[model samples]
Target: MVIRISKGSILILCLVLTNCKDSNKKLKETTVVSNIEKTLNFNLESAIADCQTQLERAVPKLTDLTKHPRFIEKEDTDWHQVPNDKLMWTSGFYPGILWYAYDVTGDNKWKKEAIKRTEVFEDFKNITEHHDIGFMMFPAYGNGFKIGDKKEYKDILLTSANSLATRFNPNVGTIKSWSNKMHPRWKQHITIIDNMLNLELLFWSAKNGGNPVHYDMAVKHAETTMNNHFREDLTSWHVIEYDSINGKVLNRHTKQGFADDSRWSRGQAWGVYGYTMVYKETKDKKFLDFAKKLADKYISLLPEDMIPAWDFDVQSDPKEEKDASAAAVVASALIDLSSFVESKEEQVKYLNAGIKMLNSLSSKKYSGVGKSDAFLLHSTGAKSLGWEIDVALIYADYYYIEALSRLKKLEKK
Candidate 1:
């Protein structure tokens, strides 16, 4: 066939060819992307099933450990009375797991128990001037209030938030919690990254109660922690010294570790979880970037199977071992940190690392199974106190369930 074109028709023909080429290129790219997504979808389904199994095993123990004034003894025989004092911290972790179980299984039992047990905080009005009130309150009441819409939880949260806000010392630009009459060194208002957890309560309270000042106060505390508590490398000490009288940053030190500069595994885990949480609440790129930086460094330090010792830098020639509890907490935190990553591959890597650690814990050697202590496997409390060591710790259960919850959410997504 003879084809004849005028000058105007020539331009139109060129335009048509260009448009067809562009469309072809676009379609090819779309097909590639679709294939990649399909591969990812398949992998996620298999990985999620494996991850869910481990998390499922964690739920029952997390439940029994957080109940009443007692837990099962390791002797594997009977229920032992947990000191009335210890119950508060243990109780702090219950609601999150309960709610999570409900979310995953749609189990009314889980929701019912969660709602019922969280009521303990209703009568539990006293807020301790401690670094752990976030873990001690939010998971029980603040989370309950936020998720379940329980008025009692809200009331408890408001009271606790008021008390927490009061702990903010203007001079230190942070909350003052650690103090010991017997040990004068423990005195003075200081900043620790761990406070990042509790500061969320302040944010929650401010948003819920129409108080902007509480939010601003929380920002100040977090800023102070960001500036002072972290080292130049962003690895953190357990404590940072401040001039409580003048609100000046003084020094960074370790409170519970072997030395001021040595890295305590659990302390770093707290940093990992706390800063990631701070990023989630604030949406500040600085906090998110800082969290990613810390997570990168922390993840690099994980041993085989991604579990870390209590102290990452501890020397082994003298036979000092790592704290398994620290590994558990960090593993849990890493699972949360995974959600914040920009890349699917990075998220999968962190998720896999967490799963590796969890699988190791489920193993016979470290889990301390059949012992009946209501704890999982490894924890090291103050050896100076002659207390917990290599035992399943409550916070471990908390993070375990928290990680599991995150995994469950990912599965649904």
Candidate 2:
């Protein structure tokens, strides 16, 4: 297949080249790619080929020859791209999936597609309204930096970290997750369990520039979340409403889960992934222990196939929609956490658990192979709200690919 880059994309290419430091600019522009063998002993060559075909099919539908994909809009059961701006939290994962594909398959096709998609986010580095800049920047630009060694990636990520840091209210001891335009049920200062995952962007910024405040704020937010977000049973509240003025805990409720008290399966995944990631970056034992408890609870609660219903308390039917995205996140976190455990038994337990989740996701029923949807399957995105339910969420695809990449690296050890 011929590589297609329009004349307009050439401008984006030049801008991408010039934005970063000249000395640090490196792009591995190569068409030859050797296939990477999966170390988890999972045969993903066929699956990845399916992903490549779907993505290639998806590219022709682009209205803007320059910009890459937004999330697929479901017209009934079919998924197709509808244009949207960069105001969404899942924006980065599209390019992120491409980057991971590049890393795993060494395919220049994925790299080129990823770079084009990444260029669209150049203006978003300065956005500060929400705490999701990390979600928007890091996986796309961060992977670009890692793959290409571009100074542009570093600069954008640092700026995004600063943008994320701006949301940190010291009085509340946490970063506000949403803008004021969120659901009216939320307080002005609502710190969510998912925000725990964004601290990595701040921590990355602090490490590179020696910014002490970024580090301090991330630590404080983790502490605050540790103190407030969890139930006694170790599951998480989706959102914790706070008094913005005095840092008082006003009420703990959910904006995304099934009910105020129901366990949102994805939120549980965030708790495990975020705490595990924070612990990985900080070496904080408390966070690691906390992550373990949440992961264990999640594992114990999983239905026989290891897939979780969107919310544990919301659905009783075995056929209810499941959040495979959350399952993927937990699988990726467990893979990382396995490396950190002191006990060999626990390590094997976590590792095997991750492999089990991956096996489930990769199965024919859920993998969405040869499906017209053009994304992975069995992902329940806010099923209770009737939004993106039982669809292939891009974030789920990102973390699923990420898990495979992490597994590939670990298998080498």
Q: Which numbered prediction scores highest in lDDT against the true structure?
A: 2
Residue-pair clash count for candidate 1? 5
Tens digits of per-residue lDDT for model 1 on 135-219? 6778877656755667656667777777777778877778875655523675667666567778878888787773577788888
- Per-model TM-score on C-alpha atoms: 0.77, 0.85
Give the least accurate 10-residue stretch of model 2, judged by summed lDDT: 26-35
Q: Which residue segments of model 1 deviate by more than 4 Å?
A: 1-81, 86-88, 126-128, 146-152, 180-183, 315-322, 368-375
What TM value does model 1 have? 0.77
Residues 62-172, model 2: lDDT tens digits: 536334443344433244453435567777888888898888788887888788888788888888888888888888898888874566678788878888888999999
On TM-score, the leading prediction is 2
lDDT of 2: 0.79
Instruction: List runs of model 2 lying over 4 Å from the truth.
Output: 1-41, 44-50, 60-79, 82-84, 373-375
lDDT at position 129, candidate 1:
52
